[model samples]
Target: MTTPADVHGVREPGLPGRLLTVERDALVPLLRGRAEEDFTLPVAACPGWSVRDVLAHCSSAFTRVLEGRFEQGVFSPACNDRDIAERAEWSNQRVVDELERGMTEAGPVIAKAGGVLDILALGEWVHAGDVREAFGEPGAYAGAGLPSALSLMAYVTCRKGHLSLHADLDDADEPLRLGDISGRRPPARYIGDGPTLVRLYAGRPVDGASYELAGAEAGELNIFDE
Candidate 1:
């Protein structure tokens, strides 16, 4: 694979904030308009989590970020379960309301934390995809925020020291260089659309999508340990 044309493009200071805002505008209304039954739908990407569970987890994380109350093992399974459990008695609208507020307010806190918390924005964006997939709505990972999301992802992947890959996306104006910034190894090759590439990075289910990868294993590309 050739070297990517843009590898350092995701280091924008306000990117995390912009991503959160875009997602809030897109996701909050959908959550508000949905029926109560829709909140109970299972998210195939996030096993054992329904739509409400995912929303609760997302909102709780944002709440933590907004409130500056991160526990030692924050975002871990037990921590997430506790966060969701604490909100179990609230109505779905309340959960969504909190999520909307968190999405709007947490971005500035994340921005001020320097680069340490940049990945939280990416996770929030991907979790939005999980919610969309569960609701069977299109554009799960690809949307208005996709450009910012991809930029943040590039930064996150590089920061986390994942393997580098040169992606040739059908919808992109140009190829993307993601993962290791030092270019210690020859970057792998990826031919696909943006959403499928996201699926690969997030380690989410990719049963039916079509894509080609070379010089790197799919398992090695996952930025999230979980």
Candidate 2:
């Protein structure tokens, strides 16, 4: 395995910056159209959520970030579910209002809480990928923030647990063995190119089981959803 570098406080590379901007702009419209589109979305990735539910989750995230309410990191599964259930019938104007507040306030809030950038970056890429997957876009890795994001995930998982099932890298012949770190701990594995991997490690898994590995010796990998 290639030894991962420590990019804990480093800013994302420039290419991802461009991609991030595009994704940020497109996110609102995608959320707004959640109800009308099919996207053939999987329930497992976002269980108990209709396409509208995903939109609510996004809106809640924007709301939390804008409110400067960083307590408990400003995002949680329960919070997302509540927003989805309560705001299920939100109008486009309502989404526009909340997103406007989010865009207006995100800068200062993030400036005050610099550490949250990692979450923001990962969130952007993962959600973008989710949107792309729903639309059946191929070669989704072309999206920005994916590379470094995945690198971060690979690094974190190595420390948290081990993989039992082998992962077949594109150019490599031998599959990477994925197993548990300790019998009782979670199994580890990398997902996505780099940024996407970081998103998964950060507990998003927006695409659900797309990156899941099977046939592990110790146990299965337990990916978190919040």
lDDT tens digits by residue: candidate 1, 1-226: 1222464635677889998999999999999999999999999978899999999999999999988898799999999999999999999999999999999988778888878899988998999999999989987888888877777878888777788888888778888878886868999999988888888888887888889999998888888874
Give the Cα-based TM-score of candidate 2 against the true structure: 0.55
Best-fitting candidate, scored by lDDT: 1
Candidate 2 lDDT tens digits, 1-226: 2322434224433323343445556555655556544533653346566544554566567676666556763456766667667775776457545654554455445445534343454454565565555566664434443444444333334434434323444423333433333456443444333323333343444454345433442123433332
Worst 10 residues of 1 by lDDT: 1-10
Q: Which whole-number lDDT from 0 to 100 does residue 224 have in model 1?
A: 80
Residue 196 shift from truth in candidate 1, angstroms: 0.5
Report the Cα lDDT for candidate 2.
0.47
Off by over 4 Å in 2: 1-20, 26-35, 39-43, 70-74, 96-108, 140-142, 148-226
Off by over 4 Å in 1: 1-10
C-alpha lDDT of residue 201 in model 1: 88
